[model samples]
Target: MKVIHIAGWSGSGKTTFILKLCSHLVHRGRTATIKHIGSHYCALPLGKDTTLHFEAGADPAVGIDDEKTSAVFHGICLDDALNLLSDSGVRYAVLEGFKGMPFQKVHIGILDGPYLLKNPEVSEVLSVLDQFDDWYTPSGLMKELTDEYPGCHIFSWAGYVTDYQKTKDLCSRIEDEYGDDPLIAGIRARVHRWSDDGRYPVYLLMAMNNPFADAAIFFRAIQKIEVCTLS
Candidate 1:
């Protein structure tokens, strides 16, 4: 998944820009968004069902309507939320107000001054939504990852499959190659079967830290297998 952050001072149009960007992405692909309500308390209605459920110790109170669905998760960390989005098969994730995160950012309005420009991670600065361009199409973003991270391998599958055995086979191959390395082995332990609707796609991304690991081998192994690519 491609993750990016949008940040700016209060009333600097962060929310508006995010809404527009999300609308654009939704028309062309799948997208997820996270808004950080930092340091402020979000109060629920005193007698609402969702609030009552939370008060009764329902950790994440979820409410679904015919038209929409919302979840209230108290005290959840950013990484955990990100993992949830990834597991749900989001292609793009745009975060609002996670400024210091290592993910690339788009600054919505002016920074304080030149001192703020010292940070090297800012990818774009926009004063208004009209300046937005399609520079980061899905294929373009995937290409950027491959260019920036040399050893990264991306495997994707779609369409009807008999079962989860195919994914397991690919994971087994990866484990066979790197299971001896303690760090890689630890990461391998976390790999498990992914089962979601075939209508929605799935992606597996492996970034090898071992300098000797050949990403080409992974490509070659799966070359004959039917797979999806960022288009």
Candidate 2:
């Protein structure tokens, strides 16, 4: 999933921008959003069913209606929230707040000055509140991998391989051998060069229905592949 954070100081139009972006993405494809309620006390009513459940120490109290379901998770971190979104199969996630966490950022109204200016992941800066169209384009917002995987059908595996050559050889071998296998389907490999550590991060995402089974088969075939420490 592609995740980006919209960050700015209080009243800098962070929420507005996030709402607009979410609307745009939902119109095109599946999208999920997370709002970081930093330090502020939640305004859930004093005596509501969900609020009472929370007070009774039921973590992640949930309430469902005909049209929508709302969940309240106490003390849930950003990563945990992201994991939930991923499990729900959201294509994109827009995070509002959590300015300290290191993820891609979209800044509004320039509150952090030089800090945001130097951050490599700060993709765009919008000085004007109404300039949403200028900053956001649904087609260009995220990296396009369609040329590599045409249907946008992909399953990612981020793990360590021996080296670049070994990674290439394994990908080539997989394509030659299991590319036609019904479970294996079309195997396309993209070696992500950027890594926090020196270990090679090889992604073997493909077009397949049973991704887990196919991934197991693919990894078993490549003896040099190792599970990555980072997700």
Candidate 3:
């Protein structure tokens, strides 16, 4: 799914802009989900079963009714949430206030910074939707990998990255460090240069004989790569 991030200071009409954007998308028969990232704490329903379950150490406490479902999660990061939304098959994932996120941004006010658009109308955003970045889950990455490098057994992978150069350098390091090992086989990387804005999203995958133990090492190696992202 394409990712759109709306960023601005308080009172910049961000919520109104997002509302208009989502409404327009809905009218056009598009599916979208919005995530609001706020600094202040939002209180849950007092004495509710879900809240009680959450307080009692459930990472994500879910409640279901005839009309809808509610979930309260603890310590869930933005990427995790986005992954969840992407898995739900939304066409557009709009981020309300994550200014620091790496994706292309639509700023609501004129400010001293770089953004895709300055106080753009919903139509303007739609005109340049192809310039936005894409998000990927592990399954998505594996699908891409399988399509590109058939016959290579990629048991595990890490992805949804934006920095191609850094990831390439890290992959080279991983090759030098572990390529000769018999356990880790067919280490592969894909740098997707499809974004109209010149950003490269990358994916790295490998087949491991011992998935549980080797995946830990693979992720630790991935963490050493310093990432620089586009706004």
Candidate 4:
């Protein structure tokens, strides 16, 4: 899953950027946009199986739209939505509101905290102030931390994370070390459309708290290599 996320304040143009990115990527070939409505509630149709099931107290009632063949899981993590998005053939995914996710945050500019994070699994993270530790599906931090993810989860955008010039410099390093078949090609970063104070939750709960504490002991086990390169 190539996940490219936009993080910033509400009025920072995140939404507009998402639209533009969609158009840009669509011109390129294939891509899909996914928006995160963190902590928001939607009342399922009264007669729908999903709604009925939830009312009947199913821990998480999952519903499927026969016409569109789309599945909806209630009370599931935002990551769970990723599972669905990946399977749907969305080659390039644009994450509109995953400020707390470890996917390289693509901001319009500064990650204004009000629109950046929420419910961080890692302490000390107050929106724009911290990077996501990627707890549930533990990302690179240290070996003990990697061991906890339990599955071989590939980086969402191991081939298209674009932004800083330093990032471009890193790509050159990867090419020199790995040869012509380097994964990244160009910078994929873009200025977003939402930049105001947050209208959505920035943080969400993940599994762990302090991956860094464990990171210190297993530094060699984790490699902070960029999985995705810009376009």
Best first by lDDT, ranked? 3, 2, 1, 4
lDDT of 1 by residue, 1-231 (tens): 556567777788888888777776676456888888887977898999999998898878999989998788776687667666655656567788877665546767775422222222222332222332111222333443455556645432223333345645654665566546443312121122322444222233334555256555435434423441221
Q: How many residue pairs clash in each candidate?
A: 0, 0, 0, 28
List candidate 3 segments past 4 Å from native. 27-39, 140-231
Residue-level lDDT of model 3, residues 18-126, one tens digit each, is: 9888887775434566556576777998998889899999978889999998878896478778767655655578888767666789999755567898898899999
The reply for model 2, stretches above 4 Å from the true place, is 113-183, 186-222, 227-231
| Per-residue accuracy of model 4 over 1-231 as CA lDDT, tens digit each | 355666766676777666765676665435666777766865577787767777888765655555654334555566556545544444466777767766655666456544333322212222232242221111222222224444322222222223434544553454354333222221111111121342211111112234434333222211323332223
Best by lDDT: 3
Listed in order, each prediction's TM-score against the native is 0.51, 0.59, 0.61, 0.42
Candidate number that wins on TM-score, 1 or 2: 2
Local error of candidate 1 at 34, Å? Answer: 0.9
lDDT of each: 0.53, 0.58, 0.70, 0.43
Q: Give candidate 4's error at residue 220 in angstroms.
A: 27
TM-score of 4: 0.42
Q: Mark the regions of model 1 whose C-alpha exceeds 4 Å error after superposition.
A: 112-231
Question: Please, what are the lDDT tens digits per residue for candidate 2 over residues 14-65?
Answer: 7777776676677645688888777686688889999999888888899998
lDDT, model 1, position 66: 97
Candidate 4's error at 106, in angstroms?
1.6
Worst 10 residues of 2 by lDDT: 133-142
